[model samples]
Each structure stands twice: as structure tokens, then as C-alpha cells.
Target: MRLMLVEDDDHVAAALTAVLSRHGFAVTHCRSGAEALQAMLPDDRAPFDVVLLDLGLPDTDGFEVCGRIRKVSTTPVIMVTARSDVRSRIHGLNLGADDYVVKPYDTGELLARIHAVARRTTPGTPDPADPVPGSDVLRLGAVTVELTTRQVNVGGAAVPLTRKEFDLLALLAGRPGVVFRREQIISEVWRTSWEGTGRTLEVHVASLRAKLRTPALIETVRGVGYRLVPPAAA
Candidate 1:
């Protein structure tokens, strides 16, 4: 994967670049938010697949940089910061960050998150070599989920969902009426275990229900998990 890593600390950047390179990632190291933003500008070069951003920068705050990036590109941005507070994480995500990774993190977990975000941003297509079953667009009553474009619609009205919210909805919609365990949902959607990430799943579910304007669409199975009931079925 091609990545733009924005971190002011030379030593830290160098270490991360080396590690990511060893894992077959093409990484461009930027010393500040300005440098990172400049690199992200339209150019002949192909756009980076993902951005690893640090909140602390010399020229600008990482949150501001994230907002700027979102205006130009939909490339997944993962906030790599030392801030571990939940508020910081929510703030970064609200600013359009695809994922938030607190410092002192497991390298394996970070790698997993990078792949997860990439999967969400990258469109999936049926292979010509091997026959793959399943349609790209999932229709459930009036709600339509165009998997290839990541667009959600309800009764012909577009529903704007965050990356995580869309992921969650798509997961449940994939198997309507099936109760997906909370742990399973977190693993599949958030790419994290059901530990500190449970609250995130809850928040996304609530948001999806609200945005879809169908509280009954996603039925909460008491003492279990959640299930998707098509509007028609409901």
C-alpha cells in the first residue's frame, strides 16, 4: 500500500518508515502537516492509498490537516497520535479520520487497522478468473446499499454515513434476520476485538439507526447482539 506518514519527529518517522517498508508498504515521510498536505495535492503521481497522521505538528494541527485532506480526497486517514482519551478519538473521527490509533500501540494492531481501512476504501469487484457469487448492490426494501460505490439510500433518499457506520450497516445487511454477535460485529467492522471497541460499535449502531430513520431496521437482540430486519419485513 502507498502511505503518506506525517510526523514531525524525525526519529519516530524514520523508525515507522523502516518498519512499514519492511512490510512491503510504500511510505512517504513528511515532517509537518504542510509537507503532507502539499504531497497530497493533485499531481502526475498516483495518489497515496492511506495517510498516517500525527496530531502534533510544527506548522499545523493534525485535525486541521485531516479536514483539509478530506476536502480534496477520500483516501483513508488514520490518526496516529499519543492521545489515548476517548474524546480525542471521537474528535479525530468526527473530523473525517477513518481510524484512530493511540500511541504505545501494538504494531500488529496498527497493521491490521491499516488493512481494514484500505479494504473499506478500496472497491471490491467480482473476479473474472474465479466466479464470485453475490451482487454488488444490496437491496432491502426501500434501502439500497451500493457496495461498489459505498452509497446508501433509503426510499430514494441518500443517507450520509461515516466510514464505520457504513461498514456496520453493510455487515448486518449482508445477512438480514441473522443475529450477529457483538464480538463478531466488532471484529468484522471495526477490525478490533470486543474490549475497548464495544462502545464504538454501539455508537455507530445508534448513528446508523438514526440516519436510516428506521429504528426497527436494526433490531437489538437482548443479551445477544443485533439483527437487520428489512423495512418491508418490519
Candidate 2:
């Protein structure tokens, strides 16, 4: 895979580059946000498969770089930073980052996250074990979910949802009243395990509720997971 490592610390970047190289990745290390952005431009060079971005850079903030990258390209970006707070994670996701890996992470886990995001963005890659919906459209009272287009609407008005938010909502709407365990949801939607991803799932659910304008649409099952409360049931 062609991967971009945007980290300013030479020691950190060199160690990570060596690890990535051993894994058969063509690693391009950029020490600053500007350099990373310049390299990301569409050129004769092979397009990057994934980006591992560090939040602290010499030239600019990582979040700004992520937003800029989104405006120019659709390549998957995974923010590797020390900010483990839920707010930072949510902000990164909101800015179009494909994943957020807190610092002091397991190298194996980081590799898995890289492949997961790359796989999701690859052309013709199927969603993780999504059930075959009877129809392309799924309707739950006032909300309408178009599975094929990945679009959602409420009361005939369009509602924009982040990619993860849509996936979470679709999973729940797929089986209304069927409580999906947290592990199951994470595995199916994010294609990752439960550890370190629970908070992300929570953020997605909260975003979905807010964007859908139906706070009661998704119900939390204490000590379990969550379920979709059909509008009629709500």
C-alpha cells in the first residue's frame, strides 16, 4: 500500500516508517502539514492508499490538514495522535478522518486500522456483513433510508449524515426492535473490534440522533447495547 506518514518527530516517523516498510507498505514520510499536503496532490506519482496523520505538526494543525485533504481528495486518512479525548475523536471524524488512533497504541492494532480504512475505501469492497435488505429503501415512520445511495431523509426533508453515522443507522434500522450488541455493531459497521471503538460508536449514535432530528429513534439498552425504536413505537 502507498501510505503517507505525516509526523514531525523524526524518531517517531523513522520508527513508524521502518515498521510500515517491513509490512510491504510504500511509506512516504512528511515532517510537516505543508509537505504532506504538497505530496498529496494528484500527480504522476501513485495516489496514496492511506494517510497516517499526526495532530501536532510544525506548520499547521492536523485537523486543518485533514479538512484540506478532504476538500482535494477522498483518500482514507487515519489520525494518529495523543488526543484520546472523545471530543478530539469526534472532531477528527467530523473533519472526514476515516479513523482516529490515540498515541501509545499497539502497532498491530494500528496496522489493522490502516487496512480496515483502506478496505472500506477500495472500489467494489462490500460492507461488513450487512444483511440483504428486502428493498433498496428502508422506511421507519418519518425517516427514510436508501441503502443503495446511502442517503437518509426525515419527513420528506433531506438529512445529511456522516458515513459512519449512516452505517450505524442503517444497521439498526435493518432490524427494528432487534437490539444489537455493542460488539456486534462495531464489528459490522466499523469492521473493528469493541476495544477502543466503543466511544466512536457512541459518538456516531449521538450524531445520528441529532441529524435525524429524532432523539428517540435509537434506544439505549443499558448493560446491553442499542436498538432502533421504530417511530411508531417511539
lDDT of 2 by residue, 28-113 (tens): 99999999999988899889999999999999999999999999999999999999999999999999999999999977678768
Error of 2 at 72 (Å): 0.6
Residue-level lDDT tens digits of model 1 in 1-234: 589999999999898887677554789999988899999988998788889999999999999999999999999999999999999899999999999999988765686678778877866521111112467888888788888899999999999989989888888887676566676678777767889987888888899889888888999978657888866789
lDDT scores in order: 0.82, 0.85
Q: What is the lDDT for 181 in model 2?
A: 66
| Per-model TM against the reference | 0.54, 0.54
- In Å, residue 123's CA in model 2 sits off its true spot by 1.4
Off by over 4 Å in 2: 124-234
User: What TM-score quantifies how close candidate 2 is to the native fold?
Assistant: 0.54
**For candidate 1, what is the TM-score?**
0.54
Clashes of each: 0, 0
Clashes of 1: 0
